[model samples]
Target: MSTSRKKSRKARASRESSKPSKRTIYTAIALVSACAVTAVAIGLSTGDSDDGGKDATAATGAQPSLPGALGADGKGAKGKNGKPKKTEEPWDGKVKVLGDGSTSYTGPQPNQPKAEKLKPGQQPPQFIVFSWDGALQGDDRLFSHFRQVARDSNAQMTFFLSGMYLLPKSKRELYRPPQHKPGSAAISFATDPHIRDTLEQLRGAWQDGHEIGSHFNGHFCGAKGGDDWSTEEWKSEIKQQYSFVQNWKTNTGYTDIDPLPFDYTKELVGGRAPCLEGQKTLIPAAKSFGWRYDASSPGDFQLWPSKIDDVWNFPLQLLPYPKSEKQVLSMDFNFLYNQSGDSTEGDPAKYDEWLKLTRGGYLNGFERVYNGSRAPMFIGNHFENWNGGIYMQAIEDTMREACPREGVRCVSFRQLADWLDAQDPAVLAKLRGLDPAQAPDWKTFLK
Candidate 1:
């Protein structure tokens, strides 16, 4: 990049970290000072697939092979000499191709609600964003399940697509993950069938109004992972990720699958890195690419977000742990890791208690924002059935309990971005004054 652009990014980052405000915006901004409300947002918002319960998967062609139980260990099938491999049946007879036959722009993002300024003195709605990483539809089938859950609860969520999930194992060699050898990936390559199933889900989710962000490829974590990669390496990894998604048809020679809805180039905004590492380098790329947000940061306090290089720094927040006086990151893995160390199968006796604790952490996090700062709750999870799907239940319970309450809108990160953009800067400045625990008297403070 250019030196001038680098200087500008540094300036933007400086502005993001140092905000000029009296008290905490979370506290003072809560009042919204009647003057801040310019216009009221009207109408019920639309989400991914709002066609009155349309079955987006009722397609005539493209059948995915039966999915199997696979781990993210990169031990799936491979081609001879590590080159792009093939399947017995590349694609079915029916095929719908789009730009370069890579991805087709189906239509406008389904049900994307237009953001409008808040009415004077109207308290901002409590925004909660639930997201998943390494969006692979494995034997668990949680991807489709959560889609139903979100639909039932009238919420929209984000699914960060792991590029390797779509890349057929036969063509695994095509991926050159940063800091890793060619054809090598930290996450297991999906069998052709898993990729097919994931594609189907991706189509349905995008059509249903959910957002798809890049999880990059190869769940490389720990040493020599994203944390160890440089900005240039990150750029290469990102480019390869998009390539894997767009060129899946050619890689696997698959036909008959309808193109995914929405152009990915336009749809993708930002993502969390593997293990929440490598963001210092990643943010520069995000800024240059004009990504709206980056969620790779770890353990943030529950507060309204600010930009990093003019891009939203949507970090995973720290949540109160009922079991301990300490706090935990608001992610399922963190809770589980704390509860059972690294073991997926912890003592069955503590199952209920662990689940309750996870649920409590999420609720506590939400409550901290809803009743206090009104910061958007960011919860991340995987599709794994760790601890007998307790995390899933906890999240579902949180959604059910928290979403139906007054002034709550469980939404995608994209929606949160729009809402943040709609707010008046002065009002936002005041809102930023609030510490997560600090709540000011609305009537008196706004006046």
Candidate 2:
């Protein structure tokens, strides 16, 4: 459906479109002293969530300042030059309330480009997906910051919300986490203020036309975590994830705030498994829930996405490391681990070195696919300031540099799946045959 990059993006804008943290990097680091560091360590070490709003900031030992939500007021805030900072208007779609009025059916997502099959000999556009795990609205408000970044960059993203974010600590009893005792969770429970902030941000994100996927409940990892969950256990997790989103009003007793703007039962589609574990059982279990994709795997060579159990599998890709023969997984925590070892707060002197490494790795991976296979690049990140907010900077740099290029489309996983599903299978197969960094011989490849 996309033709010229600029033209197609405008067409989609004539169509559809779309962060973490609840705190500043400094406050985030300070929060670590208050127990967030421990929380983040457990999550990051397990290979899944970094708990971006609160925990990620602690674990990464990052403390970069977050630009407060761009155009945060929705009426559109102004810039330093005294000009209005541009932002898309909120969707004015039809809405219908759901259970306890915690969620509602907003109309078909606004600005969402309709997916259409490729022309007989069309070249595939470059595709990139940026995603967040544990979408928390902690004191840093990283969630809101990135949303603004997306809007400003004309990009859309997926926020794999941890269901626990909606279930406040006081009401933690309502949770029945799989493979663990009820109320038990791998990540810390949210405070009342954080919950309220998170709720507002979530509502704003949907209204902005981004996709809302689940990061599941509890964030369980390790020997008794999601890795150990049975099919039924995953199902139980999915159901509870739904329940929390569906009944946040009842769960949190927040009557004044508006419910989420989309029907979650229908809106919830796909997710990345926490710690990138349990796909063997979780994929099939997700099938029953009618999810469209799963992004639980740790790494892949850049490639066109494929499906298992009829659901899309969007794994993170391996990227070239600047100074090492070893490639790295394309997520913030991995980069942090590689650079700082076990320390979230590694040598502050190496901050710039880490930042450059982080950015270079992503750019190397992206250009490889952009000029070659055109397989979508998938990146997973937390709203973390780990290594001096390098990952976040890298993402913004990617958006600024890539999205405006000839045919690059920085999009949500759902949008990518829609395009993939719309393609001819033979063409997809041919496209997949191109190596990750192998430039396509388009004339022959497409024919």
Candidate 3:
């Protein structure tokens, strides 16, 4: 045979051997496409199953395993009964719930005590606090910027680190050093060295007058199987949170340091909820654990008493920073997008809307408190929001404008709690006389 013919035959054989067969490629494509369709269907249903009886699929056995999953009625797909499913987009619907403007103050009037009156231009007792909740892995640029901003502002912020973020050596190195020991019964994240460093960084912040608070381990509330967790599971979650902080104190050679003495003073004391879930379950649990306040309720931009208990409840007072919300929502979207693993950026318009709502909300809160001497301002935002420089800058700018020397006095949550604790017993008695059910406007107490 000619050399050219031999080479041609050999090349044909090699090409045939190297490439996947047509049937195999087709089969792979079909599988992937099927998954993609299934995910898209799921994305469209997003939390509908949690709405109780409203979701038809939930009524049946066809409940959604993820957010945006189609209901059993096949709203997002064809029904088994041979009908077409109703389709919904993730962002298309409006949230039906609205905030009740009701005030909590109800009871015997304080005789319209003149002592409740504020002096000219004097602001009511309020708190200006921030939180860094969540594990430190997955986003370095955002956290690095947060550390810088906190240092520059000389602000005392709280951080709630996750134990999962302190994993294998590579993961541990992603964070800054006391490397906590792994898997203590109470403190699950203490085992990793990198987590130790993160804790150390937090301690440094505390030393610099910032606050270090617990973000519970195994309490990613919105994650699969997180919400349905049992009471025992919830107990463990709180134990992990308390243990992480306690262990850090002991292991980092700071056992002798007591950031907040037992005596009442302006100290930092607060926690953010995991996945912003667990208010009903965790609030009582937190009180049992000696936590005086929780920043999980998104009910209002001020502190309130828990419906289930007397522990002070500080809802996330500040709307999420635009970038932070985008990152979080994008994760949800990616789950819908077949876990493509790509992060989504916030739209300019969306960012603007979030800022306007948040900043304006804060100003409105200030005005209300300024008018009503009874309530205090408790603004909150997260460290992860600094992912984009602009969002971070906006938060910093808002803080400077709102809490500057001429602006509102920004007190840590702990400070506010201490101040409340220190008031004369008679004064508290008079304040508590106001009906908590009245939902009185804070503005009513102003001026």
Q: Pick the candidate with the highest lDDT.
A: 2
Tens digits of per-residue lDDT, candidate 3, 192-261, equal: 5555455446434544555555555433223232244444444445444333333333233343333321
Say which candidate scores most in TM-score.
Answer: 2
lDDT head-to-head 1 vs 3, winner? 1
Q: Which candidate would rank higher by TM-score, 2 or 3? A: 2
Which lDDT values do the candidates have, in the order given?
A: 0.67, 0.68, 0.37
Ranking by TM-score: 2, 1, 3
**Candidate 1 at 283: error in angstroms?**
1.0
- Per-candidate clashes come to 21, 23, 34
Full ranking by lDDT: 2, 1, 3
Residue-level lDDT of model 2, residues 1-447, one tens digit each, is 113322322210000000222211111110111111111111433222332221110111111111211222112134455432222335565576766888876767776877888876677888888999888887777899999888888888899999878887777657766655556666678888988998898888887878899898776566666667787678667767877877788877788998788777556778987777788899877766557789886555677878786678887766766776545667776666667754567788998888888888888888888888888998888877765677778878877777778888888898888899899998887776666777766766687
